[model samples]
Target: MVNELSSTLSFPILIGDIGGTNARFALLTDAFAERREFPVVQTADFPSIDAAIQETVLDKTSVQPRTAILAIAGPIQGDEIPLTNAGWVIRPKTLIGDLGFESVLVINDFEAQALAVASLSAEDREQIGPGAIRPAASRVVLGPGTGLGVAGLLHAQHTWFPVPGEGGHVDMGPRTERDYQIWPYIERLDGRVSGEQLLCGRGIMHIYNAVCAADRKEATLETPADVTSAALAGKDPQAVETVSLFATYLGRLAGDMALLFMARGGVFLAGGISVKILPALKRPEFRIAFEDKAPHSALLATIPTFVVTHPMAALAGLAAFARAPQHFGVATEGRFWRS
Candidate 1:
């Protein structure tokens, strides 16, 4: 039975999944079983998350959500969160004080995503490795998009521990002569090579340029969408090679993360680019590169790999965050709900 508070507070919850490119807001109608419930409003149409929330609440429904949780693509410390990729800086206290939300929670975008992973279903997950999840093991989550986001989930004391890391900035490895050749190309731009340099949308373009440069072909770097479309249409050889290499690098990174986190639960590939390259990622070369780790190749192969197909994974995560006991339990002090 739903508690009186849970039932009484059920107008809806305002939740946000803010990233560098967009800020997605949603109304979580059902607090329980959030894995399959909620409706999201596209953030691109709105200037800011606050505006989106206002418009959504005003235009969509009259029910006022007492709680708000914002998962941002930047660090959340104290009252200020300036977006890493956008021009918005938010203060949670201001939202609670001005917006009149009963409570507001702000966390790292990947951290919110990690929380949602615990509630993800088999149908929601697209496996990357061959190993069956051990039912009760740690899982790591990573996505390649505007930038790379990394986090891990460890089951502890009946709740999932969200351990966020700046793993995307970690230096990547070069397994092939071609990879070694391209490494320097990226190094020329950034003093050091990070995984984000070679695995995101612009990363795909970078890879294409390096490949064309290596082949001594004059190349024009195109936008990610153009390149992906060309590769999908089989009209551009350089685009094809660039996309393939991007997939390979992603696999290698996933493999390394699986080993580091002992992610026996699975390796989830979530992001705009992964969804765009789903057809190519299903190819043998991508799978081969993911399992190419020597000595521990078998181990890498055993970890299940998946592409997150849900467009609302982050929104679902926000709903989950609102209900998680560790987050909302024992609200006290000047916390919005308590007021």
Candidate 2:
């Protein structure tokens, strides 16, 4: 059970941002001290969370942590929490017993992203288009990586609330004539395509292959990087088209999310793909498609969008919460555990 009066975490906190491919860890010695971050390690390299923390953190640092705050790339439920795209399962009870931590708090990865949106500095993000941020209004953050992630940040009662959900799996269908022509060739998950199907890393390759199929040409690009490189270099027309269509679809999704929450604060893009495709997102195609909504086009134009530039955005967010939990209203009824 959660202790409503226990608003502060102990000193020497362990914060982690665990995703499908990589896991990053950091240590906060005290309330005012700066976070000490360690090098990133692949999730596949470690069998479990404790092993990774043992080798990457405990083995290297002498600082012992009293509590842990982890943000994983999946929903937080039960003692055995499994990642959506990764193979490892996190057992919080096991972590406390093995690591000698007093308590553990688990949150959805995108929830951490939303927390970052609330606390990030101006230079931590780069604006993609023209619009002003309404300070007290709600905001949204979504990203494309090993999979898609979406979250909302609501401001109420002088506190920031991070709302996490499986918004990445929302339905997405073709709208443009070009999209219709290429849709048939694009692979489907269970006979239909979700937003992640065409907006993630594999989605890049899917778009490339579909564009090739539509154009009656053999696809030579093997990876998403190859497609993006070719497109950025203007060396392959197919690669260029794939990236353009990707930007358009991403914009459409961003616009939809903005309207859903009435996110006048801003819509932030945070992930490995969003950072890599900064140039593509900055192009006219992204903003144009974002503002193409018929009735709310003007409203969307007034709402800003940004690419989170912080390298360890999730860690920063967790650090923020660790420093001052009272500032953010993160739900921890079932997610918080203590021994």
Candidate 3:
């Protein structure tokens, strides 16, 4: 149950989407006003999260945010939340004290992204296939960035609930000849390949290397950007093949996740990488792979897929939580104001 005070957000609530590389901030004051996007901050530029926020938020606005919600990368457990891909450790109490906020919320990045699905407008997202969102049904968000992130959202009891987990770490192995060929390359790097092994930034590099080895070509690409740029421009055949397989594998995994949650509501292709490779994702291979699952192929095909184009989607999700805590499966205990 929400206390009378917790039932509504304090004015000018602060929402942040903190990632491994960049930290995005937004301010939600007027419910009717469009959410303002603050300048993106480099995570490496600041020594701590608090310092970054202090410089980017408090110092600029000159107003202490009474309520704050943070969507961070990694699991949300205990007092100190360690970022999976970053060196930052978020301590809610420290932030509350330092920022002088009455409440603070820290949630897994994907969980927040999942919640954003409800808040996203038509312009905020781009549909990848032919289908419409099933009203009030389960929805899931998955993305390939520095790491793969996954989460689901369901509506029950008149509230949108976020289901967060480490689904990205699940084992992913060879399913096709191309995948089998890539396995040996991945094995050489991380002994055991997880779903993120071939779907993430470094994964692109890995796939590029595997393609080169399989075809006896030079593994000239050094970074994920290099591979993506080459593939997009058709500058390198191996790079192009790497991206194709990446999309194919990502589609299959997305379909599996859809079955897991029965996410008829929709599946959002979030994260920076998806936006960068929008053209590639639009290819038929992606939709084909997503709908290739037998016994449920038709069902999966009916479930729509989209790439989240809005940069501040997580911030919007946080804002939604602040407006109505009951709308999410979030619990308020101590410094944990939102899940």
State the C-alpha lDDT per candidate. 0.72, 0.92, 0.83
Candidates 1 and 3 compared by lDDT, better number: 3
Q: Return the TM-score for each candidate structure.
A: 0.86, 0.98, 0.93
Clash numbers, per candidate? 11, 0, 1
Please give the ranking of all candidate structures by TM-score, highest first, separated by commas. Answer: 2, 3, 1
* RMSD after CA superposition, every candidate: 4.0, 1.3, 2.3
lDDT of 2: 0.92
| Model 2 agreement with the true structure over 272-314: per-residue lDDT tens digits | 8999889999999999999999898999999999999999999
Lowest-sum lDDT 10-residue window in model 1: 329-338
lDDT score for residue 201 of model 1: 69
Candidate 3 scores a C-alpha RMSD against the true structure in Å of: 2.3
In model 2, state the lDDT of residue 207: 93
Off by over 4 Å in 1: 1-11, 29-47, 187-190, 324-339
Residue 44, candidate 3: Cα error in Å is 1.1
Q: Residue 170's C-alpha lDDT in candidate 1?
A: 85
How would you encode candidate 1's per-residue C-alpha lDDT over 1-339 as one tens digit per residue? 113334434335777788877667777655564432234545556676667667666456665667776777876655666876676777766676666776675667887778778777777767653668876688888888888888887875565677776788788767788878766665333576688888776677778888888777877756888888888778888888888888888888888888898898887888788888888888877778878889889887788888887777877665765665454222222222322
Candidate 3 per-residue lDDT over residues 100-146, each given as its tens digit: 87767677888889888877798999999977898789999998988
The alpha-carbon deviation from the true structure for residue 9 of candidate 1, after best TM-score superposition, in angstroms, is 8.9
